[model samples]
Target chain A: MKKLLLATCFLMAGSGTLFAQKYMTRTGKISFNATAVHSPEKIDAINNEVANILDAKTGDIVFQVLVKSFKFERELMQEHFNENYMESDKYPKAEFKGNVANVGEVNFSKDGTYNVKVSGKLTIHGVSNDVTVPGTITVKGNALSAKAKFSVVLKDYKIEVASMVADKLAKEATITLESDLTQK
Target chain B: MRKSLLLSVLSLGFVTVSFAQTDSLMNMLNSGAPVKNEPVAATFKATRIIDGSSVENLGAGVLDFRISHRFGDLSQGSQNFFGLDNATTRIGLDYGITKWLMVGLGHSTFNKEDDGFLKIKLLKQKKTGMPITLSYAGSVSVQTTPAPTLPTGDTWLFSNRLYYTNQVLIARKFNDWLSLQLMPTIVHYNLVDSSKFSNNTVAIGIGGRIKVSKRIAITGEYYYRATNADMTYNGQKTYNALSLGIDIETGGHVFQLMFTNSQGLTDRTFIGQTTDSWGKGALHFGFNISRVFTVVKPREFRDTKATSW
Candidate 1:
């Protein structure tokens, strides 16, 4: 009986460590901006309710954002973005899943900021593309913060702007993400 | 030795249980299902598909400027330019006070009536569980035209010129391309010819839209009056209202071109006063143009500088 109790305790401890290695945040922020070349027209939106998870043990990360959650300055632009560009009803969410390319370089136990490279498959508007972007991971006690800024080509995601107003839209949009995750 | 064997087996069970729990947790984290309550979009693009009100409403703080026109009956012949020479037009403005409430006012050339309505959404179809969207709209219209001079009759009361409509719109989007709606409606006329018509008219409005393309849809609507009594004016029997339209969506604008036998643009006139017959080639061509403007910024994007991504 003593031996069996010891074994069960060991197994529980092992699983507890596995759970400790994961961090998550539900209120992450993501924003994107597109600037027109000739026209003064600019389109931008912010999404605050982003779900993000990070596995410190394997250096795996995932991000999920609802396309409809994005809010824009002009309500009309937001409508067009969802209905015309994203077709959000058909594709409601955009997601990213991958790993930290240089996981060994960062020490999760140490309170320090580390520059990292993340490579992942990003799915948007029902299309997926492999993306490699530079990001930062900051560790402060039990809290972890991650951020990344990248540019996405609209055509790569099958988002088309009609020729009539094409000049008012940029070919590429800059996306920025920030998440403060806490250990599970 | 037996006790040691039992301990080993118990240890194995614990290990497997722990492993399974960890695996599931990791899998769930990796496949983070997006936390979203995304409601179905574009069930019907415009507020009105054709002659009947659709299940859609303007977003909060959005203002819609709408212009609707119905030409004279096509039976008037080519000499009248196929009814294009004479037209009854309605100009309206609709505003959304909140996500679930909207108000509208319109002035129609027919009867020189001024109409106003309030629409409230009761239920919204959502991914969570709601299967259909439902809304209620109440409209009041007052005719400004002078009452006809009677040879020997009582004076026309102010209340006699009033008309009211109550409707409940239920709609469902079956797929990306098809949407259907049913509207149970009641139109009340304070002063109706008692011998010819009832004071209250009941109607069932059926409307649907099939998307032909990303920006275009084919829409049709019909309102059937349930009252069996005949509505006659100058020895002409009133017919049910039927309209077929094509919706074209452009950025910030929705244009709908339609053909119908009803010349009235408001529910009171269209449902209770339709005098043209489709079987007699009295179809009238018409069009509705709607333009939306954002009058108030959303609370979060109120700061212009902060809104710049």
Candidate 2:
């Protein structure tokens, strides 16, 4: 009877509250397909990373990007990409300010797959836009998986392409996100 | 006549004193004059593009002071410091010449090697219909090993890099204090030494910024260079690395902490030759604390406008 009580106490102590989970990956590719006849039908990694993703309860979701810290291979492309395209030095960073579901039970012990819409505002290149993305949260014992897919238009913000290679770029871009969460 | 002779001699003494002061300044500091050059700022990290839009050329001065440190280097021999086999720790000044042109000279504290580089932005990036920012950056570096291994007569080493980055906002201001920038990058290397340098490699990097206050922010990024970057040398298996870092901003000063799989921080050495997982090891732990100083005031003769152009 005493052993049974101890087990029950341990269960109660572990009940409630979603664990703080963080996921990270930099090898995930953010590639661009450019069709320049002389440039060949080639693809390139844009020196991008989803450094970290932190999830928790109480309606708090935060994200950050170090504007000046991206890397690439080609000296030519890297120079133009930074000096001409992204004004990283001046702005230095872009961030996401929003909340996860505040009222949800934030079930920590359940073993099931749940679907929810993650809504937040994304600011980049000095412009702000609102985004509502549909994603899934999976709970398997103590681990969680958060996944989402979304699309954005560059024109929504006021970023203008220079006249030289105006016709060589894309207008619409797709962003896909997948992350695994662990106990914080 | 005696009075005139004394006046001339005093004037000559003053001229000599002024010349000595100017020469000493030239030898002690990178920028002999305190006037900071405001050069064009174009960086290849794609997230910067997605966050602020395309960068234009401009001259801006860099900080006069750089506080840099060293942890340890990978197993590469000590001769490769700065264009040799490897290079570690670089701290120096940068001057922006045009809105799009920047030049800098830095020294590696580990090997007492020095290098100078020029960066240029090719195109003014514009937002796509969907808020996509694209840009390109190119730089050339001249690094010299403290001692040359290839005949003392050969003392100079050169490295070049070209990169492209694209950044986008996945979720913006869910409220007022947060935003996210998705950045991607590609770099190219030309003119690498055969002994320790790898062929041009492909890598990916991502970064983001979180704001806790109006003027303060937290920033981080990660980089993964492909293993294909390594070519066979004397029959050995080599691999590139994955690096991650963060930056804290307060006014004009930005403090950065970096954990890299490769210890060489210069463009040629780190990107060209990487060993050991900075991700798993303790030596790759590095930090760069940098500050940006702007030249605000000009005194009389220092201001060219004071003279007739």
Candidate 3:
């Protein structure tokens, strides 16, 4: 009888019972920083992105990348980023479908913070790698906030760090994303 | 293409239309359909809504300074001077046409006494969330005559060029800083010399705009002929030359500096009269200055905004 009850309970908590949520923001920001000086200062280009979240189920979330939204402030950096680092002209969109585990009465409508894990295939610069990033999402009624920090090896993307400026660009890039999301 | 023009018209039927130089140049030139309340490209974004040549908001206007110096004057030196290259310089002005157009007027101390033209954005900005910029530009002016040569027959000459360009932003948020743009063009010359190189021809150009930071952007563009553009005389073809240039934008102005194998910004002059060799191309340093004018100078700009430009 106990086994029968557990089986019935599992069926009740299937994907059908999983609530979906959405968040959006135009001002979402994704930034990166690299250090290279006049002496032995050959460094690779660094870039980042902050996209919006679509209808995401409790167990998994999704985002649509603003392909042309990527920015590079330096001429050399911008050029190298395109020709060598991220072949944006070929693969323009990046998607992430990750899950957030562990939840107990987590009110997305209430003003509170929740620690979560983001795991998904991040496609960028013509390569996609699975990633599990530690992040947080906060909510205050309809107001939403999200933040995450992660690092990736540029080589994973087939990015050929130019031998000329590789020193400036660390093989490992530190990335950060922060945004104030609004629920429709 | 009429299709592009029609598309622009169609877009305007829906809403409306931007400039600056490097990332600024790319962003302003590329951003196409204005998504309501979207963020302006990185820099030189106006504060007002620009609708079909009408302004609902007036953003900041800048004063740009450019000094361009070509290596030689064929007129001043003649056949002897034609082959003997040196450098000449000039300054000019450019203003945003709309969100998608930019117009420019400039003068030089060499062959082109004064010249002006207009450029229209074709595609949308890559970083501002749009991809590609297809623009069209047509310019006309008389080639200058060095002293003693006198302003003879070709004084009021005219030349028109139609050019198309596309810009794409790579990776990074102000970090990677990269972009590549290509231009295909057709130049029509009012006066074509009997020489083989003097005829109007369809050429190709390639340019790159890179931003090193929020305040400075570096850009380089070159024009080359797909067919033989050299004057073939007595079994000799004057080598086809190419132009190389760089631009920097700051505050409200952009400064362009360059070294071109060809001194002429026109089709005929650069194609035929080039004195530079394959590897021994002449170094011509030059620049252009751009300034903005308003039917009604912003209330605050009336007095203090007078640019040193």
In candidate 1 the C-alpha lDDT for residue B219 amounts to 95
After best superposition, candidate 1 residue B277: deviation in angstroms? 2.1
Summarize candidate 1's per-residue lDDT along B69-182 as a digit string, tens digits. 999988899899999999999999999999889999999999999999999999988877999999999999999999888677688788988999999999999988899999
lDDT tens readout by residue for model 2, A43-161: 12242443334344434444445444444332323344444455554555555544555317456568777776666777766777877777676777767666666666757756555
Off by over 4 Å in 1: A1-15, A38-42, A73-80, A110-112, B1-26, B30-38, B150-154, B305-309
TM-score of chain A, all candidates:
0.96, 0.65, 0.73
CA-based DockQ, model 2: 0.01
List ranges where model 2 is wrong by over 4 Å: A1-184, B1-65, B73-88, B110-113, B121-133, B146-198, B212-216, B232-239, B296-309
Writing each residue's lDDT as its tens digit, candidate 3 over A47-158 gives: 2334455333344454435444554332223433543345544565555555555434356757888887777777767577989888888877877777888887878877
Better of 1 and 3 by TM-score: 1
**Runs in model 3 lying further than 4 Å from the true structure:** A1-17, A20-29, A34-58, A72-84, A104-110, A163-172, A179-184, B1-99, B103-114, B122-135, B140-268, B271-309
DockQ, Cα level, model 1: 0.40
Give one digit per residue, the lDDT tens place, for model 1 in A31-100: 9988677754567789998888887877778888888999976666787799889998888789888788
For each candidate, the DockQ is 0.40, 0.01, 0.03
- Interface RMSD for each of the candidates: 4.4, 31.7, 20.5
TM-score of 1: 0.87
Ranking by lDDT: 1, 3, 2
Best by TM-score: 1
Candidate 1: TM-score, chain B only: 0.87
TM-score of chain B of 3: 0.56
